[model samples]
Target: MRKLTAGLFHSIDGVVEAPNLFQFDSFDDDLGALLTGVLGRVDTVLMGRVGYEQWAGYWPNAQVDDDFASFINGVPKHVASDTLTAPLAWQNAQLIEGELLAFVKKLKQAEGGEISAMGGISLVRQLLFAGLLDELTLMTHPVIAGTGRHLFEPGDPTTRLTLVDSQQTAKGNVVSTYARRD
Candidate 1:
């Protein structure tokens, strides 16, 4: 089965949102290669309702390199939200309803490519609780968000995460890759 990797940029306080308020931890090209590597292997992206809204509002018109632009523009996005309607801003996007776990499990086992979730706190929590997350690729910034939406809430669940890879950049960014124990 393909892995479900959730790559997040967070503070020591576990805040994932509004990271732009903090100084970027990445130097000129320190972690660009790593991000590019992950994006290169992405076949599909799964996002929660909030993440979908944010991404739908931002990425479509961002002026960036053609490769990065194409990756976001062309990738298929599966958003788990019943409130959202069809005909979203991004191409090849859908709002999936019903048991999110079962749906994602089938998607992971399907005869296709890798699925990744970035900056989806609620979805991350759900997956974390279900132990559906295969790997967590985190880039921790030096700055901390004193207040914002935290990545971990009241779940208080125990999950296995084995560090398979890690690296730190001169820009005060530490990148780590963790695999699920199961």
Candidate 2:
């Protein structure tokens, strides 16, 4: 079975929204290498409607030479959405209908390298709540954004995770990888 790994960019205060506003100072070759390594292992990308719409509007036209742009534009994207229609504007993109959890569970059981969740707070929360996520990787920058969408909210289900690995970049971003305690 394949594992569903989530990759998220977060602020020191756990804000996961608009990372572009805070993550620039810490970006370096080390971060690039980390992103390259993570993206290289995943064959599939999963996200929610909001993230899908936002990404589809931009990534397709991004610089072709960049590793992230190239990978995201070419990789098969699966968006978990109920309102999105077919013939998605983005290449190799498809809408996931029906039950979200069931679809993800089936995908995990199928043959694949790994299913990576790019950045959808709602989707990640659901997957983590359902015990469907296998790993969670956080690239936490050293900034405290007072308010934004956080990865975890009050009344969210509590799932225990084991810290598999962690490292700090030269710019002080902590790259932590956690595995579900199952």
Highest lDDT, which number? 2
What TM-score goes with each of the models?
Answer: 0.91, 0.96
Model 2 clash count equals 0
Q: Write the per-residue lDDT of candidate 1 for residues 1-182, one digit (tens) a residue.
A: 98888888878777778778764644337777788888888899898888888877888887766667778778888888878887776888877767899989988999777789864888987886788888887788887679888777775767777999998877768888988786
Which residue runs of candidate 2 sit more than 4 Å off their true CA positions?
A: none
What TM-score would candidate 1 get against the native?
Answer: 0.91
In model 1, residue pairs whose N, Cα or C atoms come closer than 3 Å (at least 3 residues apart or on different chains), thus clashing, are none
User: Candidate 1 overall Cα lDDT vs. reference?
Assistant: 0.80
Per-residue lDDT of 119 in model 1: 44
lDDT of each model, Cα atoms only? 0.80, 0.88
